[model samples]
Target: MAADITVIIPARNAAATIGAALASLVPDRSLIREILVIDDGSSDRTVAVAVECAQRHGLPMEAVSVRLDSAGAARNVGIERASGASIFFLDADDQVMPGSLSLLRAALERQSGAGLAIGASIRRTKDRPDKLKTPDGYSPDKRQNTRRYLRNELWPIAMGSALVAKWAAAHIRFPEAIHLDEDTCYWTALLARADAVTIEAPVLVYHHDEERMARRFITAPRGTFLAIARELDRLATAGVERDALQWRKAWIAQRIARQLIKHRMFADAAGMMRAVRAHKELGGSPKALQYRARIHIGRLTGIGAGASPTTHPAMPQRTLIICHDPPFPPTSGADLRNFGNAVAAAAFGPVCLASVAPWNGDAQPVDHDIHVTALTTDSQRQAASLGWRRIKGEARIPRPALTRLKTLVRDFRPDTIVVEGVALFKLLGPSRPLVRQLILDMHNVESDLADQLPRKSIWRPRFSGVRDLERRAAAICDRIWVCSTSDRERLRTLLSKPVPIDVVPNGIPRAEGIPTVLPQPAVSDGFPVILLVGHLGYEPNIDAAERLARTILPRIRARLPAAKLVLAGRSPKPPVRALAGLDGVGLVDSPDDVRPLLASAHLCVIPLAMGGGTRIKILEAMAWGIPVIASPLAVEGLDLTADEEVLLADSDEGLADMAVGLCSDRARMMRLRARAHDVVWGRFGPRAIRDAVRRGLGRNDAGS
Candidate 1:
């Protein structure tokens, strides 16, 4: 008797793409006994198209439409309907390339008791006919499955475009109510059942649907939060050790925080906070709680919430803000972060901006009280292109800037040289060992933060650079100020030398010149205006916006047709601006004034995904006295009593449900708005934090 391999296709209306998917698998008919299409109750002709293609191919295919619509549910349905001994899953819009199926099947057959046989993926790009490679030259090897998948690294294994054994499904099925990472849960369960392998050969050719992919983010709102919660719950119930679960949860929470910051999902960011809080509540250690607290503070305040602020030892005449890109241009996300930091530092002293960008012109600063020093070295352009790698170059650090800094140290004889960015601080040589007091204002937790993100560039060099720079700075600097306590703790672990590390949180000088606006009636128009605000060029901000526009917003609208989202921020990229044109999403560039917008707004949100530090947007909204709903990550750092001042949700339904509740209950909204204003003002107010920074630096008065 020939052994049968079940191919499970969990599809939700792929009328335009299902035929191509089915056609691509024709060669694997010998290995695959049946192609089960779990029609997830798609509104379009996806079922009809799948049925027609199944008949045309003469393959054993069945389309099952169930009341449930999630892909995870659909896959479970197909698993129940599957008759084959071995199982493999394919997306309706994705397909297996030539030779991939055989390789996967062979790998599974070869294993003594393997439940999953993972394979690599090729990006079907029109620009590249062959496989797509990452910038670092690594291929999209899905087969290079993380050890966590088997060890339940973060959660369970990931499904969707991988192959599994039927024996695995009998013991474990995709848990109900998982749409975001259903495959992951399934794979994790399978991994727990038996051993697994990562095949080097390509098994799937996943079509790059930029639009569809972008849309999926919005539709699957809060999926990350739910997945994390479920995974943690499973780990707990499965009797996994508390320490092990805490470690995994810490890694997962950071990953979510980074993605929230990268994508800029302000509203959804609160979900990260929820996850961290939940984890801690679930018997997480005190140390784990501290880590979660730091991330939480960073997400809300855009600075260290729990940590004390950096102190200026004495009044300073000048301060230098260092970065790779020139602050003058203010074009990129990195530049904006550098520029904002530079401006903030200027409040303390005369600020000088320096960069490695190739320049022939002399020092000429623009707009703010900043002096620009640009280096026109031979490989400066190439070096600048390398991003974080520019640290490797000998001349990447502007010598002239250093000379000027040293001269300023002697002539102006400033009391403090606050290095705004870690990159700029790394370029500093031992020449200025005698500077009065050196303050390293770290914006991110360098070493471990990157490694914590999902689908990130897995490289030692990137992490090494962060670690080396931090250690060197700790050795030289008199004091350090990190945005998050998580970063402070990570630095403490990495740096053997003990330096006074003060956590001065980021502050958005409470939007000045606006009237002390009274709370207006909750805008009772059917559309619940969900607002997301940030510097949009950042990865987390962009990802959050795109995900919200494509996934979360759509779900909210489907439930309540009038629900709308205001994508408000400064310097939104073309891709970001395009989101406004999308249904239910209203995008705006840096407004002349955001007071009116805030005054009239009913709900304010922060849904950030990829970032190292706290987001000031969350604090700004709360300060404005708007009822705020946010992700756990968004509320990280601040000592927020959840479900009191602000509402928290981690999934699309959770977010929609929260938003709906806040909108429907006028009294609740008003109470939240009032409480939020008090909470933020009492905790994150500029005056209180400035005083805290002074105290941390051991100064009774900053200039005294």
Candidate 2:
């Protein structure tokens, strides 16, 4: 009879570890159908080690050699030669844990439809071993369909921990073009068509030695990122939701572009740019345009021209804006301002927005006019290390975020570099010499915000250190941008040296289909709603939402019993979500657009306790013709007068009183709405703001 499972081991220069890996599988020989060790152009004695281990245990084994650089390609060769019904992939440096094979086989037997069986792995360090946990609440030996498994489980789709049915393995071979994350792509492809099962027990031990760890940290080759992007594009074209896959494609293209720029791999970068332009979802994005601009500029400037005879026409000067956060989906005040500034900057010349992915999510494309690039480091350990380094007063660029930035600066060769926030000044370490001009876009006087926070706040201690760093960064930049004249003055006082400062007021795009009056309930039975729009993930917004639900809303409800509070934004943390249980408070997390919610509100409220930067939410509400009741802090940078342009309040009771007055007085509400809209259009409209940005860039360019 044919063997139950074909175990394929891809070995390359793993002589020292291959014996242990093969020996671990010997105990479960009865469960394994055949053992195939594909020596991938190894210079070491890896094949001998694997063969000896198999023979010593009286196991059925075959050995073959292939001259391929990628493990995925080697595995494809093994799959074609294997005769088993199921196939398991085991890296030469990793060992199969005891009972893992039996558990996987048992689970597969129970679920006939399951094409893949996955189990947890123990990541073994030099000093200790850490068990990688299964997704929370996952039951052992339970069968799950692909969609449900992918949606619910956070488990990695590594080859070492997966067993694929032969038919599925044959249908979905590993991607030969990419060396990085090929296993993930292969497994994703398989899971899209077949069911999968999970084994709760640890099944493999992934050894992380010094050399292997270093390899993991090295910047991935440009081809690797391009291969992943191509596969994602193919998948999207093959009926996958383009919206769901766009983020992943954006991330891959961003990384590919960065790496290409870093290594002066202009030809490859140009090819990647072309590929991104051809992609359905990414082709029209600002990120694709930025890549195109970068390639064109590089050709004209000979920035990364490696003996290429191709010539291109000279293009306008480009500006690269490096941010600490991705300015997409524009959920928060800071994100919205950054997005607006980036959009405005594009009008001056080609503008590329390079940002660090805030979370472990994929990068997203912004407006087509502004090129977008996202650098993502999916390492919790690296993040923790950076946090610790910050606590120790070290403000240098961390390696993971720096590698991509270095590549970007070298490739794009921008005329000016605009670092969006002082926190990201470390990225300037290597790019300072390459940049003709550096502009620090100070959203607010960060030091002042830190100084104003209570001593008991968790971030209080870090504020002083951060302020020192900002001061040092300010001294080096060519120019500084502040949202208000007040912030400009504050930054000048904070800085020890003189630097050019520009005041670029925050603005909003004109609203579509202007509403003459605030949206009221279509019917008489609808509740009078008070809308609070801001990203709940932000600490200040979270605090404001909690206070709104706990203190102010109750007072408003006492006066108007039918009054309702709607909290709307993206990614509300647990504490913010908990507010949904409160009476008269509704949470609308990750809404497609906050415009509809703003229209339905009788009035918008901004009861911020603490924050920096001008409030874009205030401008957005005004632009949408919604009357606003805001805290004094919310209107700090805006040229708005209390009671006329907007209702300004300080305390909880004062805010509640203003909200109650606005909802009850229709004529006063209309008056406030009209005045606020007029103020925003005249002072903070998109055309005026874009002009301000252009003028600021011109001044800096001339001065530099």
Candidate 3:
């Protein structure tokens, strides 16, 4: 017997695509007991199109016109009129796949405890092929644990791809107050009491109109944020763990703040944060505290309503250093440069470091008299999706980071603003009067780095967009600082107008003392260790680690049976973490200090395939008098002689051979290490870096 299923499609101004949506359902008419279209105050002929399609198909369908402000209200009305045992929500602009209704109903009938059956949806655009966007933590074979499911899957399960039992539908109502994320709130409430079954098949085709959706979000009124906060509060009150819901709440608030910041709606953004703070569920977490700090800072800095920027007449000169990430721990080359340069800039004036820190990172204390201010928000996570917009030279800033930056700029009122990396150059807008001089520190020619990446990488296409950003930065900045002469020349070619380009090569900190732990050969039974050190969370590092473990390490072990690989770094990603369990490989995460690992190593290996900046790891190894073997790309832009200072290899065989030979030849290893140490100290040392930074900042007196 066919199970009863009702299709409820709530639409507003969906006249253009209603016919195709209805036509796709004709084949499964027997399974669909009723097709109801609730039109919510459409100015177009949407109701007419819906009714015409229903009549032409000769289906048991009806169209109802209602006056409602939101689609959730329309959905609620449809639920009241639905007579089928199972309810399937569809969108008027989308189409259901053939036989999807029957497939969904059969799954429901098979499981007595399951109240909802979800199928995957494929997003389609006019130019691109269909892509499957499955719900987070969705598994076809495993039954979902409700609490775990809700906690893992923060994104909305496509409403058009779900079939809910009438019993479950009776208990849950659509949240009409929220204009955004309403579907997420409604589905979470419905799924709380019901077990869910996921079908691993595409049951619906969702039309992705990026331009229209972006416009809708941009134009949404401030009430939308309030409605979302209220819905989250309701969910928390219904016994869902507030901790499980906190990240989602923070994510929503941060998104709203970003949009507000984009339009320079500082006052509105502050008010929104105040309202968000009032929510019981969202108020007390670390994220909430950060938001409160941002609000307070905004009010104090005259970024909020009726506030004025305070002038510091007594201060002679102030410098603001803006970076994408906090320059502490100095794990990567970029971090070292940023930290070192900021410290150097402090010599000329009082330096304030305004940086973006991770959402979960603990607050770091200030050192070297450089005032530290961190913007902790989850906006960086959203960069993978909408980040391309910024690369395209769009005048946009991620709000969570931007708000703190604006407040700092106004409060600090720096005479000189040193913007680190091209990634954050967009923060320097045309309207700011507080900034007397702007200097752009180019970490690398980012667009050129993009071109060097593999063709399949997501960043490859986006790399072209960065060229425009660099060109704009060059046009506006008073001075441009490149890490190497090669990068400076590249930027000159990329820019239409010549900008003053200064070369400030990356430098190594002066050695305090050599490690007391002498480099020792392993016991007779133990293996000779080869150490690779980096921030394992970085993509290039991850790629290098994987290749070393999977491809290069095996070949090395084959030649020298007792060869061991040690990957020492902080915050290893899942893939990098998995390499730890491999035979003869050690994964050391977030080492208190890397010196111990470097001290015990037989040799330091840098097998990077693609990168733009010079490897600070190589320099560090050389400084420690540890012989280094690195890829040519890893040593790019450095003045080191390949054979004398470093053994360069681009292949697994060459790297393996170099390791085997160097580990056996003690005198040769010591000689190469001595030469490498001389290269680092002579050229890429403290004196060279101090002089370069002083020149770049146009300062004559840099303290020795």
Best by TM-score: 2
lDDT of 3 by residue, 493-545 (tens): 89998878999887764233332122343233445678888878777788889
Q: What would the TM-score be for candidate 3 when compared with the true structure?
A: 0.51
Order of candidate numbers by TM-score, starting with the best: 2, 3, 1
**Steric clash pairs (candidate 2):** 262-407
Question: What is candidate 2's lDDT per residue for 35-63, written digit by digit as tens?
Answer: 88988766578888878877898888898
What is the clash count of model 2?
1
By lDDT, rank the candidates, best first: 3, 2, 1
**What value does the lDDT take at residue 447 in candidate 1?**
64
Where does candidate 3 stray beyond 4 Å?
1-317, 357-367, 375-389, 393-396, 400-403, 430-432, 509-527, 702-704
Candidate 1 weakest ten by summed lDDT: 133-142
**Global CA lDDT of candidate 1, please?**
0.59
Output the better candidate (1/2) by lDDT: 2
Lowest-sum lDDT 10-residue window in model 3: 306-315
Residue-pair clashes per prediction, in order, are: 73, 1, 0
Model 1's TM-score against the true structure: 0.47
